[model samples]
Target: MRIQSTKQLPSLNELKEILSQRFSGQYSVKTFGAGRKSILVGKSTLIGAEISIHKNEVSIASSPPSVFGGILMTLGMTELALFIFPFFFKHKSGYRTLEREIGLFLQHQYC
Candidate 1:
């Protein structure tokens, strides 16, 4: 996701501070470059997001873990056969929910 804000954004550290305070325990933030950082939100560490803030634009890149990946990591063969369908649906929907939440938060703060 990419957002263009009419107002200038705060410095990276300041932005991290703001997000940390707003999100509290829901997310973890770490700066890795001059204007780039990564965040892991929600209960699972399987999904990660990279955020880049430049002047008035913020870009977010996230690669959600696949349903197959989740199953392989968290379930056994018996449970997989019994629960694959619901797991697939739930995993996908959870990602969208998280994305929307983050987008709305950023929009409210910077857009």
Candidate 2:
């Protein structure tokens, strides 16, 4: 997802700090020089976001969980039996929310 704003965007260092604090250990965040960042949300290496910022837009790209991760998650959810379906939906929704939150934070924060 890409968020476009008329306001000037925050600097890379500022963005890194803000996101790190916002995640507060729930997720792992790392920033590369020149407007690149990666977020790891869980133990699964496949679930995360790659972020890039340029000019007035911030782009957040999320990858689908790997087949291995998906199988592991499904196995983990099996303990809930009939309730497993809802957990998948909730997981997807949560990831979407995470992306939106990051985009909004960047769109609104000043450098």
Candidate 3:
């Protein structure tokens, strides 16, 4: 997805269309400074998300309370981070580097 900078936020219909195309589901988009936040477009979805670019780091959070709250929270946050990393971070290698790093880390387990 190509992201363009805009001083004014897009209308909900516009936002919804953009997000639905990007996420391939019912979704809505919001912007905060250099960040883009999104939410699932159904009632009581509870899939909250936020993304921000600060210094050289991209930060993202998606906290949705579920029956297994902690696990869902962690998964949401990780998904948000992965989705936004390429956009916010300026590294030449892009998110593929981050994905590989994470994969290697996951490959080694203490347990």
Candidate 4:
């Protein structure tokens, strides 16, 4: 969906309603910079905005790679170690049980 505004565009609440109907999810929208140059969709980290502020017309595009890269960095080394430790170290309790529990939790959260 695209919105073209001759005047600065509607408020955030108005934009959120339009996006909610279009995207079908709970979303948080915010405009950033001095001219409100960028519109950020917090839930999915997707960004939509006009390429030129003078144009007052917006476009939607895929999020930047830095967002995903930051997430990977924030996971830190400990979480990575926990995930790999089970694979390299033999467990007396059995690896299948731990693996199953992790898989179930991920499925429940994502699906």
Candidate 5:
């Protein structure tokens, strides 16, 4: 859920700019509130990441993909499903892969 690096982290704005440059062309990226949070939408998945200062580390909270998430939201049941079977979603390799890529991107960029 959080990525940490020894590399000097950029300011929030800079970090967001870096991320935007990486993801904007590839995903439908929606940035909110001055580089604080961003949502990146892909074909069957949408991921949200927030860059925040935690202690001396710049921590990023990244959300995973949801297949058919629109339908679930329309029916108002994604929350219920997540509440009941959270691991069901967290276990997806796609999510893991995305998370890894994001982490690596930050690590490589800053390091």
Candidate 6:
């Protein structure tokens, strides 16, 4: 997910503070060019995350397991699913909840 700001983006220090407070456990940050890369650790396990800060936006991606189960409950899909009930499935990926929290924080902080 990406958070965009034109003239009121949070400063680097503020961003770091927000991230440090949002996630659990110890985390380290490394800066390269215009962005920062962070690694979070909990109980000696690495929680990999990539946070790229640009002039107008911040992009976030994490490396934690995710489970997503979605269904189309529209009238047409519901009727079709009656005959294909077994088509429902679940997928896995990295975590994204932090994105929402961070996005909200940034929005409240700058805009």
Candidate numbers, best TM-score first, in rank order: 1, 2, 5, 6, 4, 3
TM-score of each: 0.64, 0.56, 0.27, 0.31, 0.55, 0.45
**lDDT value for model 5:** 0.54
Name the candidate, 1 or 4, with the larger TM-score value. Answer: 1
How well is each residue in 53-111 modelled by candidate 1, as lDDT tens digits?
A: 76688877664334444455465346565766565555665566667777778888887
Residue range 1-111, candidate 6, lDDT tens digits:
677776655666666666667553644443333333442212112233456667877776653211112223232256686765553322112234444555576666655
Each model's RMSD to truth, in Å?
5.2, 5.8, 15.1, 14.1, 5.3, 9.9
The candidate that wins on TM-score is 1
lDDT-based ranking: 1, 2, 5, 6, 4, 3
Model 3 regions more than 4 Å off: 1-21, 32-44, 63-111
Candidate 1 at 47: error in angstroms?
2.2
Candidate 1 wrongly placed segments (more than 4 Å): 33-43, 64-89
Off by over 4 Å in 2: 32-44, 64-91
**Count of clashing residue pairs in every prediction:** 0, 0, 0, 0, 0, 0
Runs in model 4 with CA error above 4 Å?
1-25, 45-56, 64-111
Q: Write the per-residue lDDT of candidate 2 for residues 17-93, one digit (tens) a residue.
A: 77888777677677643434543333244465667667877778764334566575666567764666665665666
lDDT on C-alpha atoms for all candidate structures: 0.63, 0.63, 0.37, 0.40, 0.54, 0.47
lDDT of 3 by residue, 14-97 (tens): 544554565454334444322234332221234433433333333334433233534543554686857645543443243344
- Candidate 5 lDDT over residue span 50-81, tens digit each: 44655446555554334365344444455566
lDDT of 4 by residue, 5-103 (tens): 545544544654554454454434455447666555433322222112224544443332235633543453456856655533443233334333323
* Weakest 10 consecutive residues of candidate 6 by summed lDDT: 64-73
